[model samples]
Target: MSTITLNDGSPVPWLAFGTGTALYGKDASDFVKVAIENGITHLDGAQMYNNEETLAAGIKASGKPRSELYITTKLKILEPGQTATEALRVSLRKLDVDYVDLFLIHSPSPANKEGKLKALWEEMEEIHSQGLAKSIGVSNFRVEDLNVILEGAKVIPAVNQLHPYVWKAAQPIYELCKERGIVIASYGGQTPIVRAVGGPLDAVLPAIRERLEKTRGEPVTSGQVLGKWILQKGAILVTTTSKASRIKEFLDTKNVPDLTEEEVHVIEEAGEKLHKRIYMRHVFE
Candidate 1:
C-alpha cells in the first residue's frame, strides 16, 4: 500500500481499516486481527464508535508491535460546558494507548465553532507537542471551515477524512485539499453493495452503468468503478465490510482495472451531473 507523508513528516498508510459501525468485545478484536493479517497497517476508530476496548484488544491479537501500526481516533464534540481536554483523556483511557498516530475533530459542531474548537485545536497542538498524538486533523470540514481552523491553528491539518466517493459532491473540496497539501481519505466505496441491497446508487443509474461497462470492456459494477476512479484521482480510499469474504474482495486491488482518459473524463462528467451527498447533511450545514 502507498503511504502519504503528513505536514508533520509522519507517514500514514494510504489504506485504512475503518471501524465506524458497532462492534465490540471479541467481535471487534477478531475484526482487527483479520484486518492486520490482510496487510492493513492503518486502523481508524473514534470515541463515538463505542468500541475502543475491543479495538485495542484486536491490536494486541495482531501481535504487531504498536509502533508498526498507524492508529487513528477522533474526539466527539463536547456538549455545552464540556472540554476537549476531557474528551481526549476519555478516548485515551478507552483505547488504552499512550498515544495515537492521528487524532481528528469528528465534525464542526456548535461547540467546536464557538471558541471551543480553537481551544481544542490548541490543546491538540499541545498533545502533538507533548507526543500524545503525532498529528491532528478534521473530518467533514468544508474548505471554509478548514480556513477558519487554519487561521487560529499553529499546526496545519495533515488529513481531511470525508465522504468523497466518485458519485458525490466533494470534488471542489478534494481539489482544495490537494492544493493545500492535505491528504483526503474517502469512505463509502460500496456503491454497488448499496445498490444490490436495495439502497440508493443515485449517480450510477442504469444508463451510466451501461456506458461504464461499454467503456471498460467488462460488466463493471458502480462500486468497483468508483473505487478505481477514486484511486486514479489520487485520494486514499477507506472501506469497511462486515463479511470476511467481502473484506478480502476489497483488499484485492492488485489487478486494478484501468480507465482510459476519455472514459475517466466521461465518468467525472457524469459524477458532476448526478452527484448526491451520501452521509448525513448536518456536518456540511
Candidate 2:
C-alpha cells in the first residue's frame, strides 16, 4: 500500500478503510480481517457511526498488532452545556482504545460552530500535546471556516477530511489545505459515480469496453480508475463497505494504472463544470 506522511511525520496508508452506517456486526468483522490481510493498515471510524463496538470486535478478530494499524475516530461536537473534551473522552471509551492515531472534529455543527470551534480546536491541541491522539484534524470544513480555526490555532491541523469526487473537486479548500501543509483525505472517492445513473461498476465498465473496442485497450474497473485518479490528485482515498470482497478489491493496489496528465486535466475540467456535491451544509451559519 502507498503511504502519506502526516504533518507530524507519521506514515499513514494512502487507502484507508472506513466504517460507517453500512458496516456492522459479522460483515464488518470479516471485512476488517480481509482488509488487513490484504495490506490495508489504516482504519477510519467516527463517534456518530454507532458501530465502534463492532469495529473493535473486528479489529480484535483480525489479531493485527495495534502498532500495525493506523486507527482514526472523530470527536462528536458537544451539545448544549457540554464540552468538547468530554465528548472526546466518550468516543475513546466506545472505541476501546486509549489513544487514536488521528482524531478529527466530525462536523462543524451549530452547536460547535458558533465560535465554539476555536475552543474545540484548542482542546484538540491539548489532546495532542498530552499524547491522547497522535494527530488532529477537521472534516467537512470549507475554506472560510478553516481560516477561522487557523487564525487562532497554535497547532496546525494535520488533515482535512472532506467530500471529494470526480464531479466535486473542492479545489479552493484543497489548495488552501495544501498551502498549510495539511493532508486532504477524501471520502466519496468513487461514490458519486457509483451512485450515478448506472451503478458504480456499470458506469466504468462500459467506458472501458468502449475504449477497448475502439483502441484495443485492456480492461479495468471503474473503481480502480477512480481510485487511481484520487491518488493522482495527492489525497488519501477512504472507502467503507460491509462486503469482504469489496474491501479486498480496494486493497488490491498492485498494478493500479495512473491517469495521464491530459486525462486528469479532462477530469478536472469536467468536474469543475459539473460542480456536484452529495453532502452540502453551511459550517458557520
Candidate 3:
C-alpha cells in the first residue's frame, strides 16, 4: 500500500480501516483482525469510539507485528483537571502500545468552547515531544477553529479528519489545510451511495464507472468511483465494512485507474445538486 507523507515526514497509509461509524461502541476485534489479514495496515480508532481495548485485541489476533501496522486514536474528552497528555496515556494503555502513529483532538467543541484550544494544543504538542504520539492533528475542526490553534501552534496539525464526501467537499477547510500542509483524512467517503441514494450522483456514477471499467478492463462499482474521487482530491480515505468482499472491494480501489479531471468535475457538480451530511452535522452547521 502507498503512504501519504506528513509535514513531519511520517508516512501514513492512504487507505485506513476505521473503527468508527458501524463499529462505534462495539467490540471490533474480529473486524480489525479481518482488515489486517486482508492487507490493510492502517487502523483508525478513537477514545470516543470506546473500543480501543477490543481493537488492540484484534491487532493481537491478526498476528501482524506491531511494527507492521499504523495505528491512530483521538482525544475525545478531557476530564476535570485532566490533561491531554494524561488522556493519551490512558489511550496508549488501552491500545497496548507505547505510541500511536497519529493522535488528534477529536473535535474543536470541547477546547474551543472553553476558549482553551491553544492550551489543549500545547498539551498535544507536549505529548508528541514525549514520544506518546508520532503526529498530532485535529478532527472536525473548521477554519475558525483551526485558526485558534494555528495562530500560536508550535506544531501545525498534520491532519484534519472530517466527513468529506461528494455532497459536502469541505472545500474551504480543505484548501486551508492544503495551504498549511495538513492532510485531510476523510471518513464517510461513500456517504452519497449509502445515505443519499436518490441524489444526483446516482445518475453520474454509472457513466463514470463504465468509463473506468473500460480503462481498468474489469468490473467497477459506484463505491470505487467515489473512492477514486476522494483519492484524486488528495485526501486519505478512512472506511469500514462488515463484509469481507466489501473490504476487498475497497482495497482494490487503490488499483483502479485514476478518475479523469472531467469525471471528477462531473461528480463534484452532481454532488453540488444535493447537500447531505451523514455524520458530524455540527461541523458543517
Best by lDDT: 3
Assess candidate 3 and give its TM-score to the true structure. Answer: 0.97
Error of 2 at 253 (Å): 3.7
The best candidate in terms of TM-score: 3
Pairs that clash in candidate 2: none
What clash pairs does model 3 have?
none
* Model 1 misplacement above 4 A: 22-27, 79-82, 112-115, 165-168, 192-222
TM-score per prediction, in order, is 0.83, 0.87, 0.97
Candidate 1, residue 254: how far the Cα is off, in Å: 4.6
lDDT of 2 by residue, 1-285 (tens): 368988889887888888864562234666677677767789888877767766777788888888888999887656777766677777677767888899999886653447777888888899989788899998888787788789968889999888765344478888899899989898877764565544333333455434433443444556766676777777888887656677666766335555667666655665554444565345522
Summarize candidate 1's per-residue lDDT along 46-79 as a digit string, tens digits: 8878788888888889898888999999887576
Determine which window of 10 residues in candidate 3 has minimal summed lDDT: 163-172
Tell me which of candidates 1 and 3 scores higher on TM-score: 3
lDDT of 2: 0.73
Candidate 2, superposed: residue stretches over 4 Å from native = 24-27, 111-113, 166-169, 198-219, 280-285
Scored by CA lDDT, what does every candidate get?
A: 0.71, 0.73, 0.90
Quick one: how many clashes does candidate 1 have? 0
